[model samples]
Target chain A: MPQRQGSLDQAPTGVPLTIVRLDESDLSLKLMEMGCLPGEKLEILHRASGGDPLAIKVMEYVLGLRAREAAAVWVSWGDTPLRNLWNSQEP
Target chain B: MSLQRIFLAGNPNSGKSTLFNALTGLHHKTANFPGVTVESLQTEIELRSTGKVVLVDLPGTYSLYPQSQDEWVACQALVQAASEGIPTVVVVVVDASNLNRSLLLIHQIQELGLSMQVVLNKCDRVANPGLKGVVQWFENEMKIKALVCDARKGQGLNEVSKAFGQRLAEARSGAVSTVPGPWAASWNEVFGQGLETQNLGNEVIRAQHSAETVERYRRINQSLKTCPLHETKAKAALPNGPDRLLLHPVGGILVFVAVMALMFQALFAWASYPMDFIENMMLWAGENLRQFLEPRYPAMSHLVTKGLMPGIGGVLVFVPQIFLLFLFLVLLEESGYMARVSYLMDRNLKRIGLNGKSIVPMLGGFACAVPAIAATRNIVSWKERLSTIMILPLMSCSARLPVYALLIQFAVPEGYILGIFSLQGLTMMGLYLMGVVAAVLSALVMKFWIREKGPSYFMLEIPAYQWPVSRNLWQVPLRYCLSFVQGAGKVIVVVSLLLWFLASFGPDHKMSETLTGQATPPVLEKSYAGVLGKALEPVIMPLGFDWKIGIALVTSFAAREVFVGTMATIYGLEGDPNQDGTQLRLKERMQKDTVGGSKEPLFNRATVWSLLVFYAFALQCMSTVAATKQETRSWKWPLIQLLYLSALAYLASLAVYQWSL
Candidate 1:
């Protein structure tokens, strides 16, 4: 099945999503280097009270990014379960 | 053998600094990289076989491709060391649990062709197979030795040290060229070519670099597959239960407030005993020095006892409080909780035109603003960083602690509210909160005024929490205390001497006039500093300050805490001479000091509160202004910072004095 493409901020919390591509922005390179490259699996773990900076688990680490930066990171909803994403190695 | 220099490089949060501390113990010096505030720590390590070697710990960076100024510093140091023909061995520290990703940097460093070793630090966090296989892969495929070390536990460090020694011996014995002159030249050639191609514009080059990095990671993953490792299963989820609650929207804010309240309470209560001890010790020393010297060398004794003693004592008395403040801060940082603070503060800070990362520097500003302003380098946007630096000094640093302690004694009653909170302690906390509020308000003003055109992003990695190492707990605080003394001590002493000279000698009359015993002018009023203070008195009079306070306000621009020592010196010099060799306590002297015509004490409630308000809002630290200039690379920001904060201080003090009266 074709997957829906949207920003990581729009991705459902606690669900796994695969990063499609990080848009060409100043932060994209840093985000990519921080293990947010295309094909990497990440899940939004928590959103702060103001709902701008969200915590996402990626590369076996929890990272915090604001909604503006997260919007630059385009992701596709993953078909695999969050449990499977946890068990599988980086493809 | 000549000492070989080894560079330790790693990604941030990769246990690199922990390893450096473990290796060097107490024998290291931290200095800034040339022209940059990023600290480069170099230490001499004596290996059993290889005599002495210098280990340079570079600031952490993710890649050779520079992102921030900090990363650029690391990259430049690496490239410069390679080019300088230094007998250098590059040691790349990688997080063991995150081997595949860590290899990306190793690959970049390897291309530099310098003698290199890979340390898979934090090995204890990963499973045994993962650690062993990575080591084996590095030794066999990459032809580089890799050691699995738990820097926290000091595991596998001996092997690292021994391997380093062996590598140095081989290089010295002409078996290999550690400097790799030809390899460096070739790498530079490629780098130069890349720069030439950068006419493609920054976006294109950045995209190219990102694609290249992604490709490199893919290759690293492919290579890791051949190692004898089991399928990596995310083990025992990141001990994130505490984070969940700590990062909770409502709960997190409450916890942050509670943590800050506890921190302030500890600063006041826990530091009081040490402060009192220091104060008493200073008094005792002064009494003994005066007794010992008055009969022997009266003039010399006065210089030592009255001038130097009070100056040095003022700086020393705050050491305990400064140490405690840093101890708590270092503990928070080493435990990985500080990142959470950034996360928690990000949303609120965003409203005031700062990112989450600004919180680190803001919290750090509480200890001191010099380093705190330097710490703003990590904030990506120029606008956010500038605002953070501009407002940082408003956070009451430990330098202001002595001032507050002295003034709060007079301003607030010793009574307690609800049978628990000391009014004095509450007032201290209120002053700190007032600083924070003023800082936030000023930043809000700066946000609109200073127009920076660029996107500001906040991305922070919340590392898994670890128990802070005990040695590190003390080392960090000790380093801060030492640097504080070194940085602020010299200025305090020099200013003290200048003040002493000013307050001791009046306009030089000839020897005949002194011999004729013409009634000498009051030394303080006729002295240079007193004259200057009196000259400025008309401005400060509205805030209830006499010329004595005016003198302190002028001298304290060197540092906030100098106000205490300045007062001590002024009072020590002006006090009655035949008081049985006992100096009046500064607090008592201030309390007894009455305005010329009025019976009211000089440091009454209105004046004391006004002074507190003034200090709370003023940018009094010269070092902070210098740091702001260095960090912002502009005189404009620091000048604007000084002018606005002074205005705020004046207005605030005026309002407070009027309201209290």
Candidate 2:
């Protein structure tokens, strides 16, 4: 399955997306620990009116993330089969 | 027998503190970890089987791999305790509804090879029918006993305590096994994969950690498949009704202002009763004690009535405001609105080198800066936290209110502008606005001045709205207020005593006796304080301050509210005349006084405005300085703060005096 890749900051609200990878940075560990791992499914739930900090739903919880942190996480959004995405990326 | 230790560890917002409070039941004391500023709570609990054991509540961390100082402290304590081979039991409190994320930390602790017991907290929030299977899976596959309890309701807490007793007993007998759980195989896979990327760079190490997280989640997802536990997702979203308005751009600001207005209204309106009561009671006690002891033991009477009682009273007067401020903050935080405030204010705050989390501390500064400085602990980023602490004292705290009131009454004539606003009231508001503008400009300056220690991230957790726990409402405020009294209260008392001694006697006894025989002014003029004031007069003369105002300024360093009392005593009035008639009489006396024996009034517009500007900007409160030192754990920042604020105060007051002239 083919997918369109984008950072979480640009991802549309209420649309499901799969995390592709986290940019190598100091905050990656914190993001991963908060369940923002690759192959995890999440959706942008809401955005602040000024649009810096965003609320995203992941692992049955809503996490508030700033735009800078959201840019670190690369995600893919499409009408692709969900199960095939992780299996295809497995080492 | 020596007491065994049971260390409670968990992620933030996991109800770990709630569980600790329920287990210890108001018998815990907060103390800093050795060589670190992070505070942890410790208490003794008696189990039926085992004797009393120490229960230590570690600071919350998302993982054993440390990011912030708090996480470092938590991880270091566990590893050190383990390496020492102390008889310890680690009770991992996991949020039941967020089991997968919680297990990530559990797996990290497992790799440490410590005796661990799992307690699933907030079980009432998890709506999974396979919750039973989730506990069973922990027992069967993980080889770790799992206990379920709703810590908020105090359910299954006794059984949790019983498990702690059993674990401690086993730990004492050296029979507590650190067996490798089922997660060991996956951990081996993670480390084995990490070996290939070793020594590449710092980024590689970060990448390896990320891989480990991915692997742990993969394992958790695979293992929980048979049990099929799904956390109910219906309650996860912020309800569309309230959140719509709360997160709105314009609406959010309006709501924030309204909330802040209500808090301050409640603070000043309600706290005034207790503050007045404390002031009047202290005056009565001091007056009676002075009359009783002045005749028999003059020295003892002066020390107790003048030094000790007033010092204690000054510290006690701020308690009502501090308690109310903390109560409002705790309520906002526990109900989940505090996070939204940070979310909404992040953009505007970022422009000044701070973030949304700075709003709470900034608002808390208006009540008092001691607890407000301590409140900076919630800010994880060092630069932002330091910046927030730097500008906080500039917010025109309640201590400066009296100084501003007296000055405004003297400086501004009794008249309205246009038709509605009183001239005096507008002047008071202008002083407050000046403090705010100064704070904003200072923060802007500090933004470029302070270098970032690392990349700052705002990874806040927005939990669902829920009613705050009834017990936490009082306990949290009570804990903070007690800490304030212990930390800042000491400085106020010492400064008070030192000021009393400075004002009581002079170096030349014969000259002091000759001066004292005439009146209070002559006695005060000859005292050491009066000598020091005369010495300072030349320096402050450019700002329109005379020797007497200099004395009041020097004495008010203990606290700004002491300015009125110092003025009263300097004018031959015996006690603090806080009442209306006495204040009016003092005002009349001040109105008659002249500048340098000239016909011009001393409390003229220029001098009053200058004094108001000085009080608004000066770092006069010794308690705030002490608290800043304690919170930053260094003298460097506090020293920088005092220097910068004093410089600002001097320049600003000079400008006001010259411009008014």
Candidate 3:
């Protein structure tokens, strides 16, 4: 998983970033049900209706996801970028 | 060999729902949490290989003493859990965003002598500024274990649950304990009794109270110094004043006007299309069912056209509007704007002598009174909470929307009024404003009546306005629609069928003579229901109601929305005037009542206006009454509300009728 700008042109495509956002309150309870958590690895493969929703693969399913939920998901480029994020929050 | 019960309780809006949804993951179980109608939603999970289990997710509460209805319910649940001989665990959810303030409640719960754990909720908002140091410092000083969790995100879930779980087990096994003779004993004393621990319910409740719940809350209360993160916590000093310029006496009302204007504009703009789609769908279903049913099928003739179509159609009309209302409310609530609105109202609300805390319940009153009553729990004083509960129903709920819509359509002229105002919009606003004003005035009067002073504290956290959480926002409409489909659908269907049966065949009408039976449709002139309607026509004459409208009024007692269905079902028939009058001929049958010897429409302006006024004031829903009784835990209050509303409805309708006449 090398880095690439997440192009919306093809199926099972790749993106270098994680989630940007989830619709406020909608993805909180069903975190896995949606996808990208803050600092998690995710990619958009293909999108329908000009990216109102996109099919993104996460934890083995190409789940249909809303752009709003995807937006709250903060991510970084590189498949292994999450190495920096897993640092336990300083107690 | 022992099972432990953990009760997660905190003030409302402290991420309680998120935590519940977190632990349970729909893997949870629900029953009425013991001692309150409010659900005791619990999920039991076993730590594999340890053979140890724990329950999570209870109700939210501020104080364990039970000042408000929700608080009372939460307290009772703990009581029952203690009595059950299961080691009870309490997790006090503290809003990290509002630490010192919420800690006041934490201290109280701690003082109550119960085993507890503290959750520093909304920890994601903690920016790494010196606030982190503050959190660490508080933890060092408080001598309690504190875990920071963004409950909304499942952050710290495994760690916190496991840690708190281990602590609870330790407390239960007599390894760690705090001082307690059962905290709710104070409530028992307040009720003029000593804690009779042996009473099964009390025993179960007290047993769970085992000193640990107290230590846990006390430990957490002193541990978490909640300072706003650098980015999330920045603020400038507000303009110095008793009130902002926006809330100036005259200027404030203008802002209120503008806010209401936006709400009305949205009511039409946002909901109109969805409404049309629903109506069209209903019409489509009706026509399809009509064509599908053969003319010769038994019960099929009246069934498709009258029995089924109208019943379902009536409820479907409200669905789009309900969804739209929830959508707007969710958006407003999620955006942090609902808090601002509540903040804006406090000054004026206080002038009218209401506790500022009452604003939460009053605003919530707009949605549904039952929850509005439940929402009153946050008000610290029982006097304010009780009075807030008493006046909450005056605010129109979603259930009342149909009655208002129909009455507005029939009575208020669609044309411009006062040369410039849209009369319907203005009327809707005015009616809603009336509820607010009435609630305020009622509170003011009660202030004099009860003569109690309220604690005034301005301590509040302005949570840095972040974009609203998406999960909580979208969950609203999905949950609303699901519940509405289940709850309102079943009731409407049953009522529809019952009404069809009632209006279809009379006690004495011959088959061929009835409208549905006869090709030319003979007389309903002799049916039992028809005779009763005609006889009662004189009583309703002054108010402009006729037999059909009277029938609708009678049927609508089951719930307010059934009024529309009753009218649709009865008038849909083409049966006769006397005997089979309950049939489709009802619309025509009602046209010529000739009240006061005039050839005017039987349901004229005066009568329609009176009916509108009546609906605005009436306590017509059996379900709301049942909900109120359940919420309040007594017949006296609901009975009083019913009597007052009925009297108010009748008097107002009479005045409208008499003045018009």
Candidate 4:
């Protein structure tokens, strides 16, 4: 189900979804490449060691996204237990 | 693929990115827009069952007739694509609500006579009944396909896609592109006779317009307002009443101070616990692993505990600080408060012959200088961009957190400030304030130094306050943290390895031997790093830095935190009481360590502050240097930056040392 997590920039983090659209070049381009899409499953892998380059495993490879860009990637994360547990855990 | 390139063009804030995201899906990344100076949004998408098209998001601009670098970037992309004779279709995205304003650009695109379509973006925002005429007028006047699309809501997206394929097919069939207006044709005739030949403004004018654009401008005045349409608008409607008090000259200064204070407090207090935890964990891990290996691998054990532990520990300490600073920034930005700061600063900045936009990168640089340099790209003039780049090193990056943190702990402590607040926080505040002052003064100097004429009037889009998007706010900080760790982390690792090797062995004797001969504190100075510190004595004498401090400086070239690591490496860090994460150990070593015939503190207050000043201003990171080189497309800029920063550092430190005495 496509549920609103709060803002236009974000949806609940879960199974990777296909990239539906990219909004602006300056900000959104940075977000689009961070792995939110129309038909991809993105599991929140973990943050970069510094907790900024938010890491998500997608396309079978780990991707790093800046928080600004990550907010734009409307996602619906898969209900895998390990990924869900890590994503829900408080920073 | 049938060899077609779709160009996406629109004004800034026309929701072009949203449409690009929609069209390209997940199959694209940013690269410079071919050989030109702009970034074109290029991605692959299916057009038909067996056909594919390359979508290029052209840099958004108000008009094809260029003024700024961004506009030049867009215009150049068009010229190159047109010259290439590539099967190209231009997608002109216009904000639907401001039809006339956005259509000014679409008309210019039509003048190019290229196969094109106008995407009336943000149709969702325009509830006006005039929408039908607006779309009708666009279609009737320009004759390109018009799609009333909401890039955000996926409204009219398929129509946009259909227009893309349909336009390109028309181009392939050899249709002559549209022509310019009757008035632009007359304006060109007037300008051609008036050309002074010395002015580039005329050359740009000549190049951008079609044979009859002068007629286009003339005809524009007949129906639409001839002047630039309302210049621009707020992304989310702007508030009518100005918050003049918030942006007044004096109030802006005080506000800047308070903001600086809040940042320093967050840097110092909120980030400390995590820093302490990270430092302790690294120290503990190294110490325990050494014991596990024991006497059999004495050499290996020493390497891990001393060299590796401190090096990595030094870098990780700033991770918390980076997050905290980013958090503050994300808040300020999402709230639309930065525009106010920019607007206020612009009034003052314009005096130094620069735009207010320059302040954006300068303010943002405090978090990290690399992106600050990248931010300079938005400034149009080469002179302004270069000046911004030249002064950015002085902004004081988060790397200096270690040096400043140490200084505050030792030299300045929390106390009565006019019997009111923490003096230490004030001093910390002063250091950041010093950096800002240094940046402005340097820009002023460069203003005089570079003979290029100043920029044209500064125009800005002040986005209005809206409820801070919680998703955007959270994502912003996370993004910065990731970038810092990945970029800074790689450099930190490499530098640590080099430092580990340099500090591990000595000439003709193991590092432990040299340490043992002179070390009075058993655990304090008998490590490889300690011996290395003693060896550094002669070289750093001129600057009043001893070998220990010299090692710290060298290690910090990799990153500022490594200074602390080199200290941890040289001094015994694992509960060795003398060096137990206190300022005392460094001071004792600085004052009593025998580098000369008579003992003296390696650094007095003046020298320490000067060293603090040096860290505050210099771009010492190997990562930043590499990043600078990448950004400027040459070694010339980064090299010049290093030379000037080094000279400034040496001169500042020298003066501080001698004057203090």
Best by DockQ: 1
What would the per-residue lDDT of candidate 1 be over residues A2-69, giving only the tens digit for each residue? Answer: 56779988887877899988888658877888888898888887788756788888887778899888
**Lowest summed lDDT over 10 consecutive residues: which window, candidate 2 chain B?**
B192-201
lDDT of 1 by residue, B394-422 (tens): 99998999999999999877887888767
Candidate 2 wrongly placed segments (more than 4 Å): A1-3, A80-91, B1-3, B23-38, B43-54, B128-133, B179-201, B228-230, B237-239, B364-382, B396-434, B510-522, B555-609, B621-636
Select the stronger candidate by lDDT from 1 and 3.
1
- Model 2 C-alpha lDDT per residue in residues B1-661, reported as the tens digit of each score: 4568888899877888788877875565652211112356788888888878888888778876666545655766776666667788899998787787888888777766677899988777766633678788888877778888878888898889889888877777777557554443433343344322222236555656667777888887787776546455337545375888988889978997778656655654567688788777876777788889878876667667766776676666667776776678777877778888887888878889887878777866776787668666657678888899999999888677656655677887778777854666566656766888899999999999997664566777777777777777776666666765775567656666666666666665444443334323225566787799999999999999998889878878877767765664455333443454232344666777788669999999999989999999999988789988987778999999999999999999999999999
Candidate 2 has an lDDT of 0.74
Error of 3 at B16 (Å): 2.4
Ranking by lDDT: 1, 2, 4, 3
Put down candidate 4 lDDT per residue, B1-661, tens digits, no spaces.
4478888887765667657765654455442211112355577788862278888777667655555555656766765565577778888887664554455566656665678877776555444523566566655655666767766556677777777778888877768466754434433342344322124344443433432332343444354542222212232321123344454457656877688787887787678789878767775776677778546666566566655666666677778887777677666754556656665565467557566667767766777776667666556566777778888878777777777876666557567757755676667777887888877887888778876553333344443454443443444455556666666667666766666666544444555653444322233334455576677867656666776677777777777766766665665442344545332333344344443445544445655776777777766777668767866667987898888888877777777667766
Q: What is the DockQ of each candidate?
A: 0.54, 0.42, 0.01, 0.01
TM-score per candidate, chains pooled: 0.92, 0.83, 0.68, 0.67
Evaluate candidate 3 by giving its C-alpha RMSD to the native, one decimal. Answer: 15.9
Scored against the true structure, residue B519 in model 1 reaches a CA lDDT of 41
The reply for model 1, stretches above 4 Å from the true place, is A1-3, A88-91, B1-3, B31-37, B47-52, B169-201, B229-240, B508-522, B576-581
Ranking by TM-score: 1, 2, 3, 4
Tell me how large the interface RMSD of candidate 2 is: 5.7
Question: Which candidate has the top score in TM-score?
Answer: 1
Residue B383 of model 3, lDDT score: 56
Per-residue lDDT for B337-444 in model 3, tens only? 444445455454545655445665565555556656765554545556567777777777666676676667656667666675567767876777776676667677
Off by over 4 Å in 4: A1-91, B1-8, B15-59, B82-93, B110-125, B128-199, B203-242, B280-305, B327-336, B414-424, B454-456, B510-539, B558-561, B572-607, B622-640, B659-661
CAPRI tier of model 4: incorrect
Q: Model 1 misses residue A45 by how many Å? A: 1.4
